[model samples]
Target: MTTHLPDAAPTNWVDRHAPSALRPWLKLGRFDRPTGIWLLMLPGWQGIALAAAMESRWPDPLLMAAFFVGAALMRAAGCAYNDIVDRDFDAKVARTAARPIPAGQISVRQAWVFVVACAMISLAILLTMGPVAIGLGVASLALVAAYPFMKRITWWPQAWLGLTFNWGALLGYAAVTGRVDWPAILLYAAGVFWTLGYDTIYAVQDLEDDALAGVKSSALRLGDAAPKAVLGFYVTAFVLALAAAWVGGLGPLFLPPAALFGVHLSRQAARLDVRDGVAALALFKSNSLAGLLLVIAMTAGMWDGPASAL
Candidate 1:
């Protein structure tokens, strides 16, 4: 017999207001847990914000709007694809056993159709950007396609996810400026470590199940050192973000907010209890706020004037 988790927070709008017929599909796309959408969207925004700061102006409203839509669609598509690829593994993991696909709420064929629909919508948005951004968007599919398989081969699938998820930093900058630069590179690296940290926390929720199922994860690899590893990843991410800002020519006004962002990451590390799955999941979700803080810092940098003015 199959089981189904409620698939939404008790108070989530999807749970409370979505049409009954659509709920399962929406849940299959992870619309109920919006944190992943934010996490996926922010790197793109940060890249745009970084570019705008370097140019000493606000981000392009059109590009920002496009990214919001594209991020949502693409993130949904990515989740659908991941679920499709991991359905077998999902059944063996406690936290994931009740997911739509594994619980028989959605058929594999239906999920593929959903993935295709989402990708087509995202493709329409991508086509509006320059050739460089278009190319980057196409390239991202390779990462997305390979990601679900990483856990079967490596102890650090989260690292692969970091690389995949943070591709937005590069793509966003390219979309706005028609080229990738040092600042974009740095920002991409920063996002990678940020994902590494948060994803590791997320994996903590499945440590025992993963171990039993022979899945590999950073949480499993780090063992008792997971907290320290989280701190290390966070610190690296903070430093790289600062470097990206500096390279983008952000002024002194960027420092305070950036420091605050660092403090938030540090606090997450300090408070982490890897053994507590609830706490681990909460900390993972909190990175959504952490992402917003980075966005604020980057946006503040826009008006602070360029590095030469500092």
Candidate 2:
């Protein structure tokens, strides 16, 4: 049987059935824990929905499929790159010591190869999008490259991750609308704050290990106030999401799901417990549902449209 990482679900498919030789590679990409992929991809979907609503049309299934593939590839690449940069720190942390890199399952050079392969595939998808979306995809490279170092130099690496992961919102909107409008920007901002909240909760899982490894995080920086900080971040995220809907001229039908989204976030904050890592992880993973709700809110906004397109 495959040895599961501390963070991976025991029954995850990668551990249950993946070929032994490929298991290390899949783990390197965090395929054993698919929550990150959903978190990374949903912002793009929300943007697609918003852009479609703006045009009073349904989101393009072809474009959505492309983004789904691209997001998975890019997230895998990003995770491999992060592992390459963070091998040493990861070795020092109990939660990360068994990762493919730190545990000797994959060589740094091999991981680099994986990163390149995934990034090249993602680039191929980007090339099929509009010029503005392609440019935004290229620009996101800087954020991805800069991310692993943020934990070393900043107390809030989650903020940088927010910027990096949610960039898909802008790119997706540009792909459909061929322009970066106020709605996309606002939606991107909301995604950033949403990430800030959930990732802060995730960081709680590493508070002790991170502090011991000398890695700074919003959770460690806030100390006992981590939950409160998460609450603040979620509040900002909820407000910005609504603002994006309003500015995008969404109708009243969007409010109910949006309210549910807000309630979901509120409950996460209310139940947050900095001392409980398992609960923190559960809370972090719940953001996927929250992201889907926001996507629904955006889709619901298109109740009235001049015309419709698939």
lDDT value, candidate 2, whole model = 0.90
- Candidate 2's C-alpha runs over 4 A off are 1-5, 304-310
Clashing residue pair totals per candidate (backbone < 3 A): 0, 0
User: What lDDT tens digits, residue by residue, belong to model 1 across residues 1-310?
Assistant: 1222333457988879999989888888889899989898889988988888778778888898899889889999999999999999999887778788999999999999999999999999999999999999999999999999999999999999999888988988998899999999999999999999999988887778888899999989998798999999999999999889888889877777788889988888887776787777778889888987887788788775666654
Instruction: List, residue by residue over 1-310, the lDDT tens digit for candidate 2.
Output: 1112285877999989999999999999999988999999999999999999887888898998898889899999999999999999999887788899999999999999999999999999999999999999999999999999999999999999999999999999999989999989999999999998999989888888887789999988998897788889999999888888888888777788989999999999999887888888888999899999999988888885422211
Displacement of residue 124 (Cα, Å) in model 2 is 0.6
Question: Residue 107 CA error for candidate 1 (Å)?
Answer: 0.9
Name the TM-score of candidate 2: 0.96
TM-score of 1: 0.95
